[model samples]
Target: MEQPAASGPPNVAVRAAEKRGYAVSKEQPERPGRPTLDAGRSGGVTVVGDPPRRPHARQRISTTLDLIRANPTGRIALKIFIAIAGALVVTIGIALIPLPGPGWLLVIAGLGIWAVEFHWARRLLGFTRRHVHGWTQWVTRQSLPVRLVLGAVGLVFVATVVWLSLKYSLGIDVVAEVMHYLATH
Candidate 1:
């Protein structure tokens, strides 16, 4: 291609950008490293994604896990320890599930712990996360009244579980007590 006299690259750049379907502008080009609207569409916008993530603590385990994995016996020991820890947390969560607390949260936490070392657990955890995220998105998309009704339904479910747990585990029937009080009043 023949160079356009000595008119410089600015005009050529604008023509090139326009040809590429960019939102070209005549504004002065910003310095390197920082793009501007004149540069193109979505220029100058620093859209950072979610921070780097891991199911486990990276800093704490990075060096230690490598060191331990290097030894044959240590690998077995590590697996054993992880299994025991994950099982303990899950057991606690199962025991607490009937009560009013973070039982499900603990269960998921235990799964995350297992996921740190187990491929099966990682896949299961991912499945659980995707479903939960979908549920959240669905709920958010609903109307206000529908969302409120869903919240009320959740409250009722929790209340029933709490009542059942108290009655069965501690021999205390809170619902019956409240009913008796209401009758006397």
Candidate 2:
């Protein structure tokens, strides 16, 4: 029998092909412990690796924002737009606070919108996020009975507020109306 023919490693052939500007795959193969610079979708250079140093969501957002704010005139315009939009959202959120709706959620969303342009808003958002997390943790630590009691108290408080708001603001007495309707029916 003839001796077996020697064959070069598959990777060596692939690497040679790569040097000749011929990529077998659309996605370039990533090697461990080495970083590679690749062209990004937006025509920017992106560094990728085994442990890829991809842009954070915030970084990407800021980058897009920065592009929009390259000139002083554009920057001022963006700032104004953000401020107006954020104010409107926050105002609506504040208005909805006393009503049964996503008041806090809208408020946080407004803060996020403001955070895109304002450092103060970013700091306040972080503070609010921390406090909310703390409150959630504290509530979770309470006993089931305590939690239920707290919930009931909250419900009572909300009902009382809603009733008072309706009675004073709109001259509508819901409880009396309900009683009258029930009695008649």
Candidate 3:
């Protein structure tokens, strides 16, 4: 007997299974070549979804790199330009590091900018990507309290560094200014 179709949000794999006259079950083990969300879930937890289909930036970068690589005569000039641009980006990133912004990301991006033309940069970028991915996974696996405490500690460290920098550079504490304003007002 044909059972009533499962009523819920549409899923690609479930639809496909229904089309093929196969019963769809939430607890059904994933079969090869099937896009099963249940396969990705463990103990009611999902690790990651599908990756992006296409990255525009990646396409642009590859196109630019291919153009540079094809022109053997202009290779040296291109390399020089790439190096200068990457160095400038890295310098700017370093300057922004203590200013509460995407400093490290910019630095990694600069390395990526260089990676297109430099083998060493490519290796370094891959290494950084791997380590960062592992670190992210490890952090995600930590208990909430542990994660919160680590975050608090990091915040305190950055605050302390910022305070010291402001005190040394401008001879005034921002906290003191805020306090003075509060007391006078």
Candidate 4:
């Protein structure tokens, strides 16, 4: 004689169990309706299934930090580590921002790094996301000619910034060089 399994969706059961904080058990019940050993948040209710499946990557990383924070010394160390790493990323992003080549990408990445550990950064990231999304939506909705004009304006802006940066920061006068080349030819 053998006991039959409980009848319900396994995924739902697992999710409910995990949300209420119980380790999942794959084994079939010794007796139907009998609770697992680590079954309940309190005597008021029971979670009769397994824990959540592997968490998302973000959750996994957060759990690692949670584990580290169990110790007071480890908590301090983690904060210091996050601060230094985030600052380094932001600094590099700032340095590269004037010259292009994934400069904005790096700066956003740096902001993301800081957002993980700081509330201010998290809010700022949200604001940035919203504004960028709005801009993209606005651009996509415009007429072809309007969009083309906008693109031309953007190109001109980039060219001006690049020319100025090279000339002023590196002493490389691109317009003069181009003129000299044209004259020689």
Whole-model lDDT per candidate: 0.71, 0.73, 0.70, 0.72
Looking at candidate 1, what is the lDDT of residue 59? 36
For candidate 1, give the lDDT. Answer: 0.71
Clashes of 2: 0
Instruction: Name the lDDT value of residue 1 in candidate 2.
Output: 27
Candidate 2, 176: how far from true, in Å?
Answer: 2.0
Judge candidate 4 at residue 72 and give its lDDT.
62
Q: Write the per-residue lDDT of candidate 4 for residues 1-185, one digit (tens) a residue.
A: 22334432355655655565555544432544444443344443544565425445764465556545645676688878878888888888888877867788888888888887788999999999999999999999999999999999988988888999999999999999999999999
lDDT (tens digit, per residue) of candidate 1 on 75-174: 7898889889998998999888878798999999999889877999999999999999999999999999999999999999988988998999899999
Which window of 10 residues has the lowest lDDT sum in candidate 4?
1-10
lDDT of 2 by residue, 75-105 (tens): 7999999999999999999887777889879
Candidate 3, residue 142: Cα displacement in angstroms equals 1.0
Error of 4 at 137 (Å): 0.7
Cα RMSD of predicted structure 2: 13.3
TM-score of 4: 0.70
lDDT of 3 by residue, 39-91 (tens): 45455433335542333565445544544444555468889998999999999
- RMSD from true fold, candidate 1: 16.3
Which regions of candidate 2 deviate over 4 angstroms? 1-59, 182-185
